[model samples]
Target chain A: MSQGNMNLTLKVWKQKNKNEKGRFETFDAKGISPDMSFLEMFDVVNEHLISSGKEPIAFDHDCREGICGMCSMYINGRPHGPKQGVTTCQLHMRSFKDGDTIVVEPWRSAAFPVIKDLAVDRSSFDRIMASGGFVSINTGNAKDANNILIPKYDADDAFNAAACIGCGACVAACKNSSAMLFVSAKVSQLALLPQGKIEKRDRVLNMVKQMDEEGFGNCTNTGACEAECPKSISLENIARMNREYLKASLT
Target chain B: MSEKSFFLSSSIGKKISMGLTGLFLISFLIVHVSVNSCIFINDGGITFNAAAHFMATNPLIRLIEIGLFAGLILHIIFALLLTLENKKARPIGYEKINGSANSNWYSRSMGILGSLLLIFLVVHLAHFWIDTKIAVFTGKADKHNTFNEMKEVFSNWYIVALYLIGVGSLLFHILHGFQSAFQTLGLNHKKYTPIIKKIGLWFSIIVCLLFASMPVAIFTELIK
Candidate 1:
């Protein structure tokens, strides 16, 4: 009820299943509270839908904390609406003014098929990660974190790269559909860590190989992924990934 | 899932093909720039014209041209297909982006800049290559050397202006393309990555500017 001062229209994508034809259906959102989170606003709309005996729009969401990255709606032409570094769940109704039109839809990628109205199958990302994401650390003994003693610079870089949430927003924002940012982040994360250094060459080669195999486009270096990423992951990671791959190839 | 199976897929194959072909095009620009520098020699116009003529008529060069064209076609096709796929992959834009200082502006505008370069290439080929090659083969052009045709075309102000703009855009393209192509090839590293990127930028700028100067000199009557 915090957004009660504003009136808005919601143009949301609706689909019964993956094979179902989807369309944007509009709904009136009046007396919305300004303090309501985007998801909370959705709850209000769904309440209205349920009361009217309408099938509520199904969207992927979990943790609502932005770390889980389960919220994958593209709002108003941006991955997480216009707010930078905020996930859809973290976005508040105050981000918009009254009488604004909000367009919500799921991620669109061949690799990510729509499961329903606003939910998509992001399993391709899992497959990409499974390709070569983790280092082969022996699980029998728990080593102290201090034992690694990686350079400060390397640790920072690795941490930055690891910040990627496996959100497919970068792939969507890219004009060439390049996943260089995502793949590079994964490659760089492991490549920077000492544990990851052992299989650095193989890891980068395999992940890049998997990325290409997934039918993602070549990295045209458009930097859109970096721009659109909720984590604000740098393109430098992609550059770093490139450097690792080249070294791997030569070795 | 397996490495063997992964590399064989058309997507991977196409990306590899694009990376290699793009690298080849970069190399061609270097060679083309070197040849174009002959305009500065002032050897009674003999040296430059001879080089130009050889490029136009040499069998080996023709073979290379075929490869170049193939690379160009594949690169464009793959680029288009990839864009369409990416469009499908992320129908929605992200809500918040964190890192912006990590990449150069040129790196972000590669697609738009590349399309511009492609348009420029078509115009360039039509004006220079098609005009001369087709005219020569079909007996429409007089028996003047290819360099003379170039000179005549370059003498026009509009042609000079167009060539300059094309070359400027190409310079921008190469600046980003050189670093990007390497990244696509998975060449990121801490020790030597920055060095390679700097080299890529300088190479692109110098080569593109060198080629661009030829038309400028001709238009200014400095070559005559």
Candidate 2:
């Protein structure tokens, strides 16, 4: 749908740091090429701001491709603009009209305090990952991958769970700011594999405990996380983690 | 934190309680609908009265009655707490929001439906339970003639309409709650979830319809 250039208005959030109050600053993004990526469009606007001797808006982004879950922005209320299954980086200007005014904001959650205009400190995810999101295997010898002989279905399910890129979109999209989808993805990715089975008990238990400590909300099964996920991760991972957690708690 | 306290305090832990209590309440609905359906025997409420009499008199069921109340109370308390916390989580809301693209209306409106059900429960208990239980124990009401009380209650068209509205709310609540309870408990399987969802829909419809029909039938004089 990329076509000719278009003029548009943009309302971007601006904050000096976590402590400072933020506000949306409007700008005229004139002659924006429809073919340009959303990030590129942002770059154009930032360059214009720089040339005009104004403080450019700060937003987090890396590896303009969608794979790196680094780029996070709430555009017009959705986690990553109007599209589904696409990160903010992959979002194209084609999704907008000639004069559309796009509203951009950072992920809002108690656990993810805002660091800048559109960047939130997502280290809570790293804390959850450290709390049993790993398996211990010796470095001395390498085992055959086929020796584990996981079923194709189980392997596929594990791969799906592992597809989560640790994006805070799930938290941002959830009405309660729940991190269940993110935590569940991590738990299920390990729980589905034999190599990860050894630490399954402590893993689910520890991760859940850490998740709670981070002040994330509970999963009410609203299914918003699964819907807004760029990777289209299934809600099944949450259920799987729940099963793993229940077993771990009982044992 | 202690394991028990953690389970009680944590979001997921409270969710588990919601599931467990919700499932317990579902069982109560099954028993209630079954007992109430006895009025369909078309024998002037003979079977219905006998079942109600037995339920009120049997010490075993009486003990279970207390447990049922506890389950209901716990369910209500946890639900209210969770809803409040969920609301607090999103203190600042979007101006141009679109939630319909993501989740079902019923899933999102559970708090409102639950509140309606809560109101319905209070009214229902006042209408039948309080009067019947007080009279039965005080030897002022015949335990075997509770069907007459049912008739008297349904005689008012407003009460019947209120009951129908309550059952309507219940239908929507259970349609989401049944599968959600199991999902929260981690009983979900790729193969079984669809089946469970289907069963949940049918179960809610049948149970709520049966409950609604009692009031309608009594008001219409179809059962008389």
Candidate 3:
């Protein structure tokens, strides 16, 4: 390894299933290469766990590439560990030094109940989406992408909102446990799209209603969600959502 | 629990309360500034004092005052609870919080600034509300002249300075609070987010400047 080697003490959460009681179990990881990804180090730890008659700490992961938005973990005290815009799988051990004591936990929102160990059931995100995330485009109603001819400004704005991956990191990071950023992104993405114009009012109304139903906290404008988000989603989305809601309410 | 009733149970409900209460308080600021501006219209403070006396006694105004008190209490309570929850949520700070550089400074310090503003509110109510209420109840002011009372209060340079600093903190808070309240209500579309944010900033600055100007003008003898 080009980077120096290091040892770490891991306090990993272990739960058998959603209903199971979980606790932190300590493990010593020595001979870890600093360049190894955080998940890679986890892999080494898991290998040791399996060989030592222990169940490996189960976690949710799909794309180690940070794009899947599946790697949700509270590293030290931050969501997706400490590295900005990087998932836990993408974070390298080089960010830490030898003999570091790493504390890993799951997202702590009431909306995000733990499924097991470091994995949380983020289906609340899916529910919020199902309430009103997409345009009501029907089959055989295909339209040319450029036919709508949205202004460049609107196009760019929609793209920024569409970049949200439905991760619950914002909820995890917000002091109020607010999901305004996520709901606003969904509302904004469609509101900006030309095809979404037909249902803009209904879209915001239903999504916000569902967001409320899901038990998310109100946004206090603290911006912790934006600060900790792996996607760098802007708080501007929340402002847009507010405008949409106010307009919708008037109608 | 019933799904429809879960709004109150959800994190989103807490946010909605925070937003609504915050916006409501901002409206109170507008009224307060307007009433305070009456002082400029009356150089001898007679007209302003009469108006202030009328406002203090009006039934409608009293009703709204109760609402305002409820709003302030809820705003502070929820703010404290939210801060504590957030602290418990992320027990450790990040190592390299990437993209944090992109967020606005006001957005990050909502809690700290809010606390300072809360402290300012306590002193403000004590200096103004308590004394005024006491005077109103006792009918002790020279013909119920609240403006004279205000003049006495603002005559102190330290009091004026404190009001200026307090309003300044409030301005900083509204800069973030206005937009964030909307976001909490789930208003996250991009087309208008930037415009709302700009409006929030300008609104904060304008209102704070106008309110702060009262004490400043009084202290400088510009309004005498």
Candidate 4:
């Protein structure tokens, strides 16, 4: 009832490990300051649990900023709280009402198994990246950055695509739990760049093949990923990746 | 993946099929709408009857019609499979979700729109296509009259209302399906996609409006 502070109900998913079943456990989060970040609120709850001699809820997060994409929490049906274009770490308690019941869970996808609580094993993304997300070049002397003479437009697109933070939010927000947006961002980043063109032919094919192998769903162009994406990754990258994949498959 | 499995199994490959078949069906709609638009010739159904007769008698058009049916069947089957797969992917859904915040209703309700269109198609085929084909094959060739069929079907207010409803569903379906097909096939370009989307919106409106106008015109005696 105090100004700038709210009592909230948190429904958080809890799991012992990847092999254990998960369930939602409710807890009272009282007198939370509006300025506190979402993670900070959870930290308070964890501290309370620890003080009470109960096991603290486990979650994955490193950088409290939005850059790392490690704060993968689904809040109230959205990938990262109710806000658009932000990671869970960047979400503040002010977004919710005083008595809001926030439901938090991990990314639900066949490819992303829950490790424990809100943390999931996102190694499938790493495997897909390792498949063909690299380019080979003989290193000699450091060439001037302008030696390649990249177009400004392509550079902009490459930079935009490169902004993907490897978050599984796209998979979580998607109705089909597809990872097309993430994979396409990586594909577009490489394909749009002059330096990444050497392996473009094999890169899209390999990445998509690996993506399918990981049991990810197909992109239905629902636009959920682009909307929920912390990096604002466009669905155009998926189209571009599709173009690349088709060309690779045909030729 | 094997060549067959690649097209049948992979997500992108399945989308490619949806695109190809969708485009094929779109092309069929243009032909169908054009042929039906002959009703507006206002020549006492003479021009429309002749056009319909020509379509029925032409061997090449007949062959292409077979392909059109095949394409339609494939498009429907793929749509169903994709819908099922997508449904299975999210076995447990969210307690609270906002669909319209990201995409339009038509894009999200493709399966539902498609089902409505399917119902409309079945009624349409039962009313006209089946009757005409039966007349052709049952040695009742002289009874084959598509113009009279149109006049008779539209005379009833219920049938006219149904046709308008069907056209309405078709409008929403094609509005999303048009550009979505292009996006799925990877035909998107930064420079051209906005243009494509605009064209798709107008195309859906114009085509469905034209078709819808036919039923209204006939029912109102504007064409008669």
Candidate 2 CAPRI classification by DockQ: medium
Query: By DockQ, is 1 or 4 better?
Result: 4
Q: Provide the lDDT at B90 for model 2.
A: 56
Candidate 1 ranges with C-alpha deviation above 4 Å:
A1-4, A133-145, A199-202, A243-251, B5-17, B30-47, B50-144, B154-172, B186-224
lDDT per residue, candidate 3, B89-114, as tens digits? Answer: 44433332333533566676778788
In CAPRI terms, where does candidate 1 land? acceptable
Q: What would the per-residue lDDT of candidate 2 be over residues A28-51, giving only the tens digit for each residue?
A: 888899888888998998999999
DockQ of each: 0.28, 0.49, 0.24, 0.46
lDDT by residue (tens digit), candidate 3, A19-108: 776777888988899888988898898898899998888888887887788888877877777778767888899899899999887777
lDDT of 1: 0.75
- Number of the predicted model whose DockQ against the real structure is largest: 2
Query: What is the lDDT, from 0 to 100, of the residue B96 in candidate 1?
Result: 33
Interface RMSD of each: 5.5, 2.7, 5.9, 3.0
Query: Model 2 misses residue A116 by how many Å?
Result: 1.9
Clash count in backbone of candidate 4: 0
Worst 10 residues of 2 chain A by lDDT: A132-141
Put down candidate 2 lDDT per residue, B90-188, tens digits, no spaces.
555554556787888888788889899999999999988887688778976454477888898999999999999899999999899999988888887
Candidate 4 docking band: acceptable
**Cα lDDT of model 3 overall?**
0.77
Each prediction's TM-score versus the true structure: 0.76, 0.93, 0.72, 0.93
